[model samples]
Target: MIVLPYLQTPRARIRLAEASDAPMLLRYREENHAHLSPWEPLREPEYYTLAHCLKTITEGREYALQDRGYPLMAFDPDEQTILATFTFANVVRGVFQGCHLGYGVAERMQGHGLMREILEPGIAWAFGELGLHRVMANYLPRNERSAKLLAKLGFEREGYARRYLRIAGVWEDHVLTARICPDG
Candidate 1:
């Protein structure tokens, strides 16, 4: 099994999602449904349940073990409530050596630079430990906050895609951006 080390900033701590986090994960999703819906895929009723969270956490752990993905959860200093999540998915080995980045923060936690704090070390781990060459993050053009965040994090605009993803039950376009490994 891949044992991930904890990553911390002054305001929060990040670690791989665990089965034990199911209840809080479910609660986080439920509480932020409306806040996140515009940026995420439409969810079924079961998606907010404890069982779903358990299954997802289990699968995420398995995927991490296989080096296919890293699903991380960031929590407040109390370490009980989930404040954000950052997923490094679609990890490609060989010539690609890259992954897609997806992330979200609690509605109440926005505007605090918490996502930036969470991602800095996470991306560092991807480059330093995982040896990835590039990390891609995409956002809707209308999401100025996300655009700004990605840019601030050194992700350059690569291109745009039409109907790039199905979010909120509709196909939405996305602005593609990527950051290459600084040491590469």
Candidate 2:
């Protein structure tokens, strides 16, 4: 299990998801349904309910404990309001030392540099605590913000993959990017 430490940015707090966070998470998803739906997979009708949220949280914890993945939530430091979520999945340890990242910030919080603040520490922790050598992030070519954010974090644009992901019910092309930890 990868025990996560609380990470703080200028305006956000990034930490692991717990069972108690289900309601907040569900609320965020509900509010951002239209905003996120375009970039995410289709969710079950029940997936946004409290019960589903709890199940997700519990599964996230289990994955983290087993070092299978890391699911993190970002919140406003002052208000303690849920602001976004991110996950480090496809974790391959041992000699491989890599993981794939997935993240999204609320629409209202889009231009606040919150993503960078959240990603920097999270990336650092993956490299430091997880001893990962490289991290991969992918985004639709049209997602300029995500592209810029990844570039700002030292990720190099490696190439493009067609039909790399199923987004909004369609297979979409993505720009593959990677960041190597200098300390690794």
Among these predictions, the greatest lDDT belongs to 1
Over 2-59, each residue of candidate 2 has an lDDT whose tens digit, in order, gives 5675889888888887777888888998999999998898888998899999998999
In candidate 2, stretches whose alpha carbon ends up further than 4 angstroms from where it belongs are none
| Cα TM-score per model | 0.97, 0.96
With candidate 1 superimposed using the best TM-score fit, by how many Å does residue 93's alpha carbon deviate from the native? Answer: 0.4
Q: Which residue pairs collide, candidate 2?
A: 1-65
lDDT of 2 at 8: 90
Mark the 10 consecutive residues where model 2 has the least summed lDDT.
1-10
* Count of clashes in candidate 2: 1
Clash number by candidate, in order: 0, 1
lDDT of each candidate versus the true structure: 0.93, 0.88
**Tens digits of per-residue lDDT for model 1, 69-133:** 99999988888999999999999999999999999999999998999988998999998888999
